[model samples]
Target: MIGCRHRLRMDAAHGRELRDVVEDSGVRQRREAAAAHRASVRDTLIAAAPDAWVVIDPELRAGARAEATVRACEAGAQWIWGALLPQEPDTGRRGGSEILMRDTDRGGYIPIIVVNHKVTDPRRPGPADFHPLTSELSRWNPQPDKSRKLRQQPRDQQRLAHLYRMLQRHGLASPSLLGGVIGLQADRILVHDIAGVLDDYDRRYADRIAVVRGQSPTTPAKVPECRQCPWWTRGAEGASCEQWLTERHHVSLVAPGSRAEVLRGHGVTTIEELAAWTGEAPQDWQHGPFDEAVVTARAWLAGAPLVRRFETVRVQRADVEVDVDLESYQEHGAYLWGTLLDGRYRPFLTWDPLPTTDEGRSFGEFWTWLMSVRAAARAAGKTFAAYCYSRTAEDKWLYESAERFAGMPGVPTVEQVREFVDGPEWVDMFQAVTEQFICPNGKGLKKVAPVAGFSWRDPEAGGEASMSWYRLAVGYDGPPDLGQRTRLLEYNEDDVRATLALREWMSPRQPTAHSAVEQVPSLADFALDPRATPARTPAPVTASGGGTLST
Candidate 1:
């Protein structure tokens, strides 16, 4: 029987099938059986040596918890088994540990041990969403008496101090342990000794602790969350509230940072205001004090193209180029690595977990085929390049797969994989876009790929939707949907094609400094005009590359 955390993670990856099981009587019986088995084992261990450890179930009542705590304190047990206790309500903060262990009588303190599913390595920090402790640390005040002094210290020092204090408040005098089930065994680490891990986090963040504390106001950042905010609406009914006081407002297209703050400071809070503003432009442009933000905002308001040449790079053309995109379920590994070779769509898929036909096997096949194609190109005295929109996901999966399949037949050497990734043959189109343009819509491939005249076959095709499809395709939730695999493949193929389109649009073959900006069309243009000629429809391209070009 799976734990709630693991079950939830599985449900998230594979849709909401586990949610149904959670309410089922059969599943409840299984869970009860599992719990009983665990309880029996725990009881036997405790009975053998009561002074070694004490157990406190979180499901116990308040009175029972108090009784258990008192009993543990009296037992002279070295370890107290219970979830972290919440702070006093008056403390005005949040954070707790997973376990509490008695310290050796240096100062009669209790040390904390946080149990998480994730493996936290001080050397490599995981994604921002995975680090809940960081968020907790930002809100906690370790030393309320020296709050001013703490705030004055560098943000890094302040963060460390807050973390240190949070642990101390929980009765920990020594370094606390971050324990988790990594792979099959239990892994643990001392928080204070994780070298350079917190430093990396500090460098990545801009001291937003004060903003979180409500001591300072923060300018809106161009993060994924901003798109979902209630204030993000425009022209929709019931959009404006008392705070905004207007329905004509538009969100700024500028990337979050100094320029966005400058715009906000100048009373240009909305796209409508930005389009109308005639004040002095901010001196934030890389080339000059050009009103790029205003221009982009106006373009978005008018539903016009937003493109301008601020910088350019010469991309070497390859004889055989393949635009690649990977789709993976984090809990189950990568299932598909799709490619658009020339105009043809090809996919390397892994649907089974059996050793004979698993993701690792499929990955091995894909690697071999890719390397052979590269060799063929080299033999013909031409170059081969693989274009991927972003390196973060693709590179991560590539290395992970290589490690997972190391020493296996048909798999490439780890060194070979690293060399390919680091080589010039692998082009990161996202990096290319960042070096060339400052898009108000931000640097996401989904945002800019459309600007390059590319469209997905399915209107609903996206990262989240694809994950759901993959779950159904793998039969993780229930009976497999046979059609879901095709949908997943189509989505992956569309992604690669989008990457290809972007690469072509930004290639040196295009005219230099050519802007795609056009005058904003009037609202009447959107309405049917009898005088307008019917738009010509292009022929569809087949999966095997033979077809008339659309672009």
Candidate 2:
């Protein structure tokens, strides 16, 4: 209910066909690392505690374990170390939170989940998210703390609610409806009000139950989750939603989500139908450029990957431009900052394991180098700019790095980071592509960069693979693989290079005659003068039979 419906369908109907994306992704390893971190935190928390806790043996049988837990609850054990709990009989919903503490007033328990991400920030003077609790000095005692604003983790809260439901069913819930979270910093416990999230949880839970019971629609829609879903793989006969959509050239290929549904409502069932469409758009149409969407479909039909929305390509370009790409390890820190300038790739990175204090050195070096580049460009009266595919991740790390290493040598102040990012000189090429072109497929850097004739050296060059490589390169799990370090550098270099290539290709005048306006078809190529044209029926864009793309 919370995620992809298509994946839900796959799990329900063809549970065995889902493929684990292990060939080039690090999701499994990353999950393992997270689990390890959670366990380590749990171990330390339990180790530091007094003698009032109850630790159940995980190896015990279900019935036996349930009995043990019941015994502990009956005895009013102050703490339950593990998150595991007994399954309920009626709904069969069963899961555990990391830690459970006895609610003194309520005579039951509430969970304190161990999470590997930040749950709160230093907040302003306002109503507090929680009363801070320390285990040793202030165990079970929440003290006044108005400086913490909770980071809303609805999913986690939903999990807490799920556990709450199960506990309530089993008569083990705290009447207060409170839960706690131990985030990455583990500085203090942030008590969460489960009642606040219970309504949303109930709604989601009911919907999901409907989905599981075949009472709700299981039709697939193209969502971000589709890219990572194992069921999206090929050769599931007619089961793979990805194969089904791509092979049929689903209208969602161009007009995704609600727009695709809207098109279907108007008899534009396929991309071909949308492409051949010559009538007025729906009276209630509000989606971006209905005509531009038709052109995108036409581009897809013409086997063109991209369609030019504007006649002459326009993108920000500087006399001395630098392409930038940052590589990060989970939520720890950015380990590498790769930059390209003067046709040279410079990688300022740390070989020391992540979360190390030495991360400051690498970050400081990178910032100092980048600032020098900008300073020199301004001093010489040459325009300077930096490019990245997207600003979200880079901006996050930039701001975070500044905060994390504020007083380090060469580390810029937060204001400096803010000024640079907000400036027009820091260009996000992805934004430029979305503004200027109609990509029949998605407008991801990997997809769009290929249109600009840029390719990574390694076929496995992707964020997922980089994570696995980073682990090996930094010896996170074992002895450092030097080969992966080189591979990482090459990958980062290619990413920055890809950004530069894409920017140049979008430029109207460049050394290479590969400008998008010249290479790709403009709207004029397949566009019909709607006022002068008559209505036309859709031609078959694919083979004879195919299923509908939406519910």
Candidate 3:
């Protein structure tokens, strides 16, 4: 409630959030140069369009762009195309990205027809984030929606539906640069945000725009839209993933001077330490025969927070940070798994299906409660909060009974705990919680929870515990009556309880401010002169699947 007005005012800007304003202005200037470069490339492409081809500028308010472009695409004219030529690289980066989307709803992909620019390493040619330009090939094709059906329904129609609904409820526009890239699709998914596709229901309604909900059948082999993302190939190998480790080491583990000395000892006095260590190396090295300094280095990094911990050494401003994690169903659809801080663990909420009545519960049922808690937190002005959600699938029963229970409200409001369900903004708030705040080493709850004094290593609080320990206090055998369901509710409640407990437990001890080089041995070199480091090249890291561990 307190920051609501500020958030509202800021949200008014649509694509241009506060982070767009940089202190050095150099990044912005570079972005401007890149934009100019793109414009030149684009002009050469546009001039090449055939005489009869039709062009449409689908630039609406920020988030609304996708729907508008979708509308243009549905026109079915032989040459339907659009362009998002902003004047800055980062400026309207969101807007440009939104406009570049194709009908991803039905596993359809917009193809990139041209690339006038040269990309760096072909191994990692694309930016870290996917960049889809299939929608931008507008100049080559005829106007979309040539048929009478095109006139009756347009891609933007779904967007308009969402826009009107959002306007009615919040009087604010979608924060997306191109209206919810997957509008109306928000309701289906548990983690509803622009990063993911719309739910199945809304995708069905999106006639012109094809849905890309499940795993793409045609895995482009190379990364998509992310290739152009700033995070893509920009940092050292594992730099993005190791950001949390680096920051944690800087703020929590090694003292600045000692850290510098250690890195220098490795001949990695620069940011080029990409090959000098792996995030897990410290732990790995400790087992081997290493000198005390090296051992200390390993020890320090092993204990760092899961998220990025260091502040921008050069910039002085309000520091923003967010700790996040996700939870989902695992086995028997009763238990769920959570991913945070680069670690995956089990959350104990589960329900046993019964023949008489209760069979399978939907994610929405649990999510409703989570949303209410978040609403309560927002209403209370809590900061640096962490959530643990299980990231697992549901039972077959859950999928079969979907229609009747599809939109059923789960979490109860002040009026009725199960009456008022939260809207997408509530979900968006969770999504924005990170973007508004910095994430460590690209880590969130899974990684950070462990480092911030949480120990799944032990059972009493954070150690290994049984899945049954999380089950309803009562035995699972039952008629699936309300009494049994109540126990299940308690099981779910314990998760929130533990999450809050961890947040409270970790709160006071959080690094109050950035550790000065003098304080942290690991951050000494970075603190000494952050600017001295050259661009880092990272060693290729092969991602491993979830490790088998019980908690």
Q: lDDT winner among the candidates?
A: 2
* Sort by TM-score, top down from the best: 2, 1, 3
TM value for model 1: 0.62
User: How much does candidate 2 score in TM-score?
Assistant: 0.83
CA lDDT of every candidate: 0.53, 0.77, 0.30
Better of 1 and 3 by TM-score: 1
User: Superposing all C-alpha atoms, what RMSD in Å does each candidate have to the true structure?
Assistant: 11.9, 5.8, 22.2
Candidate 3 residue-wise lDDT, 1-551, digit = tens: 11112122223432243354333233333454455444554465457665533455544653454454445445533333352222222211122222232333332222222211222111224333332211123322222211111111232333333332322232222333122221111111011122232343244333211212222121111122232233322232234312533443432123232344445454443222421343333432332223223323332333222212232222111111222232222122333322122132323233443221132243445445445555665676743233332211222222323422444455122323223222212122223223222222333333333332333422332111233233223244333355434433443344444343334333333444533211222222222222222122222211113221111
lDDT, candidate 2, 1-551, per-residue tens: 36776576557766664455343356586567678778777677667875767887778887777778778878888887664777765564777777778889868888788887787777657664464433321286665566766677766778889888878887889998988878777778877678988888888887776776677886666766666667666445475677788778788877877787788788776777787777777776688778888777776766666667777887887889999999998888999999999899999989999888788899999999999999999999999999998889999999999999999999999999999999988999989989888887678888877766677799988898788899899897899999999999999999998888777777833455443346566666666643332133222222112321110
Candidate 1, RMSD to the unseen true structure: 11.9
Q: What is the lDDT of residue 316 in candidate 1?
A: 54
Per-model TM against the reference: 0.62, 0.83, 0.26
Off by over 4 Å in 3: 1-327, 330-350, 353-404, 407-444, 457-498, 505-525, 530-551
TM-score winner between 1 and 2, please give it: 2
Better of 2 and 3 by TM-score: 2
Each candidate's number of clashing pairs is: 1, 2, 90
Ten-residue region with minimum lDDT total, candidate 3: 183-192
